[model samples]
Target: MKSESLWFIFINASLINNFVLAYFLGICPFLGVSAKMETATKMGGAVTFVMLISSMCAYGIHALLVAVNAPFLQLISYIVVIASTVQLVEMFIKKISPTLFRALGIFLPLITTNCAILGLALFQTNKGYGFIESFVYALGAGAGFTLALVLIAGLREQLEFAEVPNTVKGTALTLLIAGILSLTFMGFSGLGS
Candidate 1:
């Protein structure tokens, strides 16, 4: 990853190895907020913002920990930073768009617990990515997550009027859609290399 081109890094993260579809890191928001395209987009933006901030902070924090020879604290430190970043994003969204804030409900602050953010930090560090590489990776992961959410939302929206069977409705239908979407992403696996 240190020598990988920025384009490759972005494409790999956003599509080939997507945090949601490939790694299944952030299923909570992927399913919860994906009920509507509007909410899904907003959640995607919020998650992306958090990922960007956390990526930068993770880069700095990893360097600082290594410098101090306290690498054991890495996991706890990442959680703390992710929590704080989510708080900042939550407050900012509340101020700029109260409707969205309410619309997101529990899932808004749930970004802190969304494993995709933490996974982004950990994956970049493990891959030995530099600051720029980490940033692009985070951006790609966020983009991929948004893409998955939007796709599911759009499909779920369409399913509403398809007159589906009663037994196959709700979670069953959502999971069925998600499984197909995940397989669809698998077709892009070759592009990462």
Candidate 2:
């Protein structure tokens, strides 16, 4: 397979076709864990690790399935890989820092179901990425997720100080901000062209 440049894959995945902003995958963690910068950063790191691991596993499994003519198992296999990866991350976090584990709470386990993780595996396969391409794509997706999370967390933190009318406060304001951010990310669509 002819491979695209690594830089192109990285930029396209992270900026142009962002999993959260562009594809709208993994909105749960994007909204839930992004309330604080510290939590967001940790969530991002954990996601990145899982994405990389799952991407690699998906690539290998895809090849095997194709070789054996069992492509029907793609989705199930990918989910298994992602779930196992999230479990590892959960245990590691619990052992290293109980405080962070508590803060992350259910979201850490929820990562197993985060469409973003499954999406990474599916997208890489759909794009026919090689092993290296899959790895870079995962890295880029993770970075994009982190970028969006951090930006929202920062904005939410600032919103705490802003005096706003009661009608437009709370989730209404957050959804508005998220919509604006998603539109802003749309500007990068031309980058891939």
Candidate 3:
């Protein structure tokens, strides 16, 4: 059971069920904050931190909900918890690591409304992932999200020097690139199946 759950979490989070592609949760940051590699890396770290903490909190709260048989409140409960946690994390980062915090500070509030973080919590509960499983799943999903954002940032940075067409300048080109990247991720679908 342990081994199976571990494998399931890793594969699901990493490839077969990417948070960005399969779930379309964090498209906001995936597009907005990915302009520069430096900012992208900071955003990724902040997100990963939030994800890991939220996964643990979500799993514990989910267990409580299961005990009470009040699964209907899962969504609200998860959001409340994640939002509060993100706020606390943001403050801590601002005080402790101002430089790092500034880099990610602007993006911190954004994650509060980021569907990806909430989706991760809800999905873990809905799927009945154990504690360890949830943690690993969150880690994998964070890694995948970071990978996608960084890759896009790198591409966009290079495109800065290139002669992009007028029609496909700002968002059109980025979305098109994202579509191509999504197609690239599709190639990994068969790995865990």
Candidate 4:
């Protein structure tokens, strides 16, 4: 039964309902950090990595909350745990791979503030997902995020060569493109229904 629920959560998190296009979470990065293809890809990978870690940590914390009968602390605890974990991951990345650190440094800390990461943690608790379920959900969500970011970045890179209007030069163009992408994702609304 629990195994079935985990599969359901993973599928829901990935394709049926994605964090960006479906839930509209993490739009800041979606629009702001998606200018350059290389940077955007790096940012997506960094976010996915953080999301998985944060999800696992949040699940463990949720278990502790259930044990202590203080589920009310779930929100605060999850945020703290996610932030700290991002920090640790940032440091480890810096130490392990200086090139990756340089590519992802600016975006690494930003993941701490990304609403999607926090939202994933909160939603996992709200949905009462267990350890494996939460892990799979996080992985699926991260993949969804990466897919969205990479696709948008690729489009934006192509748009660079196109003759976009001056009024929609930078942010305006990106937002318009994102709006279109969101509509495209709407086609997947019935994917797992």
Candidate 5:
């Protein structure tokens, strides 16, 4: 809750306490959208955009709720913020690139429910981060989520033609790769300590 430098907050969110690989908060979209590089990257953008908006709005809503002695509305308020942000993203993508839009499918809309965004909101609120700090935290979290998706998508794409045994083909191989990637991210835990 104490003040931390912006870079430290960024590094901590993006690497040390990664919303995906580190905390495993957003596994659904992580696995579902990570199959293709295009969809994965787009999904990451969508998620990041949602996170940033939701975090900012959550910070404001929390302050309002506190001012009115209604902190109990925090959860529902945060959900509304995330849902609204996702809707805007959905409409934007639909008009901008239908191909990418189609590629993302259900997972695109599912950003509304992605726990990583919610977690980021809650974490920032609980930590009592100021507006700028919350913004930077959301940025780092988004970058981290994007990095993880791109890495997994690239690796999975490469593995497609690797000719492995049947037992290690689908989800099995993906999980194996995810485990390794998680460990790889663990290396950054000591980054700013």
Candidate 6:
């Protein structure tokens, strides 16, 4: 029973209720950083790392807040945890790959405010997921986010070679592709239902 629920949560988070395609969260990074496969992959990795860490921290903080009868602090606590985690990722990227870090630019720091991360924490808490469940949910969300970004990046890369019209060449084409992708993802909403 426990395993079944966990599996459902994972699948639901990663596919059915995908943060990008379904919820439309984190569109900033999705549109801005998905121009190239390499940058998209890095952004995905960073978000996954932050999501995992923030999920764990949110779980612990929620528990502590509950124990202390201060559940109202959940939002603030999650924000602090997410911000700190993003900072760590930013510093790590800066140290390891200055080039990638520069490419990421302001979008990297903007992860702190990414609705997907905040939504993940809030949703897990609302769903009353346990520690392991929360971790799996975070992982699923991260994977789903990465999958969406990579798919869009791949499409955009291919689009570079295709002859596009003057009006639909840039953002117009990107938006059209995003809409198509969202509809395609909606097809999976009924799985295991």
Give one digit per residue, the lDDT tens place, for model 2 in 1-193: 3557999999988999888998999899988888898999999999999999999999999999999999999999989988999999999999999999999999999999999989889988998999989999999999999999999999999998999999998778878899999999999998887
Model 1 agreement with the true structure over 102-143: per-residue lDDT tens digits: 999999888999999999999999998998899999999999
The global C-alpha lDDT for each of the candidates, from Candidate 1 onward, is 0.92, 0.92, 0.86, 0.83, 0.90, 0.93
Error (Å) of candidate 4 at residue 75 is 1.8
Prediction-by-prediction clash tally: 0, 0, 0, 0, 0, 0
| TM values, all candidates | 0.97, 0.96, 0.92, 0.90, 0.97, 0.95
State the TM-score for model 5: 0.97
Question: Which parts of model 5 are misplaced by more than 4 Å?
Answer: none
Misplaced by over 4 Å in model 6 are 1-4
The sequence of per-residue lDDT tens digits that candidate 5 reaches over residues 1-193 is: 5669999999999999988998888988888888889878878888888888899899899889999999888999899888888999999999999988888898877888899999999999889899999999999999999999999999999998899998888888888999999999888977967
Q: Which stretch of 10 consecutive residues in model 1 shows the poorest summed lDDT?
A: 1-10
Q: Write the per-residue lDDT of candidate 6 for residues 88-181, one digit (tens) a residue.
A: 9999999999999999999999999899999999998888889999999999999999999999999999999999889888788888999999
Q: lDDT at 110 for candidate 5?
A: 86
Model 2 residue pairs with clashes: none
Off by over 4 Å in 4: 1-7
Instruction: Report how far residue 140 has shifted in candidate 5, in Å.
Output: 0.2
- Worst 10-residue lDDT window for candidate 4 reads 1-10
By TM-score, the better pick of 2 and 4 is 2
Global fold similarity of model 4 (TM-score): 0.90
